[model samples]
Target: MRRADRLFQIVQYLRGGRLVTAHMLAERLEVSDRTIYRDIADLQSTGVPIDGEAGVGYILREGFDLPPLMFTRDEIVALVAGARMVRAYGGPAMARAAEEALVKISAVLPDTERARIDRTEIHMPLWVVSEEERRTIDTLERAVEARHVLKIDYRDEAGASSCRDIRPLGLWFWGKVWTVVGWCELRGDFRAFRIDRIASITCDGRVFKHERGKQLADFYRQMERDEAARDWAHRRSQNAP
Candidate 1:
């Protein structure tokens, strides 16, 4: 987590006049107690009204609040709708983060905007994504961020099963389906594997560095070229007829 986000979380935990210990904060933020102490000191130095010592618990005094966030109605609707979609279709950790983001956004917004958020009619059905697929997506997402190599047992559309070692590049969501775009060591090219079709996936404890042709940008370029070729072929067929 970024320092700024950690500090914000500290303040959020300290709200409602609740006393939160540095150890507790450390555990929650996955940081050391000393780090939490320093963060608290820094927050206090910034005139954040956080009152507490090293060992004792810290509390945000009553009436303390973050500045109201400004958002137009359309922007608010978009934000709320997107968050709701993620909460329904995203991974477990992502869902929790989305919920917390909604809470934080609501906390900083003016009452009118906050009410608009509640009134936003957009929602997503949670049943569309299976729990297993959600977990796979979360794992693939982490691997993409960390540049980890993964071994996956994948079943293609033709029902052939194969295990491939892949350098995870990125995840693409096609409305109802989720696919991981990766550099396939077996095929020596980019392959998009559907998350639901992956029977098993495990990290190989090895990381990969970005290569010229094996990157996500290269995959996108290849896709564009393929699309253009298809369009050209269709145009030629129409002209021939």
Candidate 2:
């Protein structure tokens, strides 16, 4: 990876709570410690809020945000690769978001860099599926980002349809599908709706608040427990025969 790209990765890694060492960055970016140090200097010179000590690991300043501009070549590669993966496996909204993000990235890049991004190839096959599920994922993602309420028309595996008003907590991408985990007003409980099974969605134009990460974690744990119980019951029923 280039020095500029390595610097961007370091910034993101630090933002994600990783304690990055010069040696570690060296290994990860296929460069020497000296090169890593130079890259760090470049970042610091360019106004990135990276901090570190002699023996302790480096970190980004608390609440430090990535600049709205500036992306390195390797960083572009990673973004393209990830976006392509999302386009392949994520729901329609995510794929569209990936495309939009790439466009934004290109807009921010310098002319030469923008041309390079356009020419770079990171290929991935997308799912050949109908787009009926697209709008729900799009609205759910907006709700998650903006902390808004969504009116949902959903169906379960049994094909029972129900209308619900929900305060979306977050979105989940698992098992090649998108799920919205939210506080459902109809059920008076936190619920997860499969994006593909959602028949319709409308934003209520009202925002709600909850512990975002904690709520998602709790929902995932409950889902795991429910799945486990079903597996155990299936085994017991099979043995009873």
* Number of the top lDDT candidate: 1
Please report the TM-score between candidate 1 and the true structure: 0.77
How does each model score on lDDT? 0.91, 0.77
Per-residue CA lDDT of candidate 2, range 59-138, in tens?
Answer: 88888776466678798788888888777766677788888988978776777677777667888665533466555566
Error of 1 at 114 (Å): 1.7
lDDT for each residue of candidate 1 in 114-156, tens digit (9 for 90 to 100): 8898899998899999999999889998999999999999999
Q: What is the lDDT of residue 132 in candidate 2?
A: 62
**TM-score, one value per model:** 0.77, 0.50
